[model samples]
Target: MAQAAREPDFRTRLQEWIPKLVLSPSVAAMVVFVYGFIAFTVYLSFSDSRMLPSYDLVGFGNYAKLWGLSAWWTAIVNLGIFASLYIVTCTAIGLVLAIFLDQKIRGEGMLRPIYLYPMALSFIVTGTAWKWIMDPGIGIENSMHLWGWTSFEFDWIKDRNMAIYTVVIAAVWQTSGFVMAMFLAGLRGIDNEILKAAQIDGASSWSLYRRIVIPLLRPAFLSAFVILAHLAVKSYDLIVALTGGGPGRATELPATFMYSYTFTRNSMGIGAASAVIMLMTIAAIMTPYLYAELKEKT
Candidate 1:
């Protein structure tokens, strides 16, 4: 009996450790690759590194110079416009789609996948496709002209004044569906009893949503905002494949600026500084949501 009890205890301990042992390698890689690089980048931001890593400390010199640059300012302004429109448009479209789907309309199963199909494609692919569709000579304008609509004009992609909005349109096309999924999940999780009670209390559909349904979806709203804001701040590939930060830097977001400065311009220190600022922006958006989530759990 003593031997059997000892055997079972050993087996139980082995079971408990198996998962941890399996996860250790991933945790170790994350520590070394993810966090280690982050720390190194932060250090480089403070140093006089340019073209390559340098150990000479320059303090906030890189940051000061970065703030003074006209290109950096242009990137900042473009990001503000892109992020604002991206977030608002995505949220509005996603919320509306979610609400529509929640009503259990016919072909619900078919429609959900159709709505989400764009998101399955990588941003690079989406950007490239949109680039073709928006090109003046071969895209919408050309096609319209060939069809005898000679006066048709849709050349926003080449226009400096309207290029950033084109980015917004592409981004919204790709991400709004994902936001829809988030809101849909939130809607599904809501208790049906509450909705029923509101209906019995003589609440109209609009009033019901405005007062109760929308209020309860606060968590979804916050989540969508945080996600969209983070994406907007770090957007690179989509802009690269679509606009290449062109029309004379009309869509030069911080990500593109960081890459161009660090690698091409040989200003690693300033690039690192910009990267740190971007990281901080993401952290600022994430920290509050994480705290609220943890607080609710506790």
Candidate 2:
């Protein structure tokens, strides 16, 4: 009897230990690669490291210089514009698309995939394709001229002032479908009984959606905003492929700024400072949302 009890206890202990043993590698990787590197970056930001990392401390000198630079200011301003437009435009377009799809249209399956196909492509691919389409000499403008519409002028990619909006356009095209899918999932998860009750209370279609449906989609809206905001802040590949951060630094964002200073300009300390700032910005946006989400779940 004692031997049988010991065997069961051993099996139970083995089962518990197996899961942690399996998960240990991933946890260890996150600790070493993700959080470890983040801590190293923070340390380097205060050190006088350039061309290579050095341990010599410089207090806030790097940060002061970063703040005073015109290029850094331009990157920050550009980020504000791009992030704002990208989030708002994506949310609006996605909400509309989700609502349209939720109407149970005849070809819902086919149309859904078509809308989402752009998202299936990588940002690098999307940026390269858009670059060709937006190019003045060999793109839409050239095609239009060949087809006898000589007056058509779509040269925003080369225009300094309008170049950032071109980034916005490409980003929205790539991400809005994903946002739509988020909202669509939220819409689908909503209880049908509540919707029917609202309809039975003499609520017109517009009133039904406005009061009941849209209110219930608050989580989706918040999720979309958080995701798009993070994407906008870290956006490097799309800008690199599409604008290369300019006709003249017009589309430079924090990510590009960090890379330029670190590798190209040999200002590693400043670059690390910029990276730290970007991390803080993301944390500020995410912390409250995460806390609220956790609180609600608890």
Q: Would you list the C-alpha lDDT of every candidate in the order shown?
A: 0.96, 0.96
Score candidate 1 by lDDT. 0.96
Cα error, residue 151 of model 2, in Å, equals: 2.1
- Compute each candidate's TM-score over C-alphas: 0.91, 0.93
TM-score of predicted structure 2: 0.93
Screening candidate 1 with a backbone cut-off below 3 angstroms (N, C-alpha, C), the clashing residue pairs are none
Q: lDDT at 187 for candidate 1?
A: 97
Q: Compared with the true structure, what per-residue lDDT tens digits does model 1 show for residues 1-298?
A: 9999799899999999999999999999999998999999999999999889999999999999999999999999999999999999999999999999999799999999988999899899999999999999899999999999999999999999999999999999999999999999999999999999999999999999999999999989999999899999989999999999998999899999999999999999999999999999999999999998999999
Q: Per the 3 Å backbone cut-off, how many clashing residue pairs does candidate 1 have?
A: 0
RMSD of each: 2.4, 2.0
Off by over 4 Å in 2: 1-16
Candidate 2, 254: how far from true, in Å? 0.6
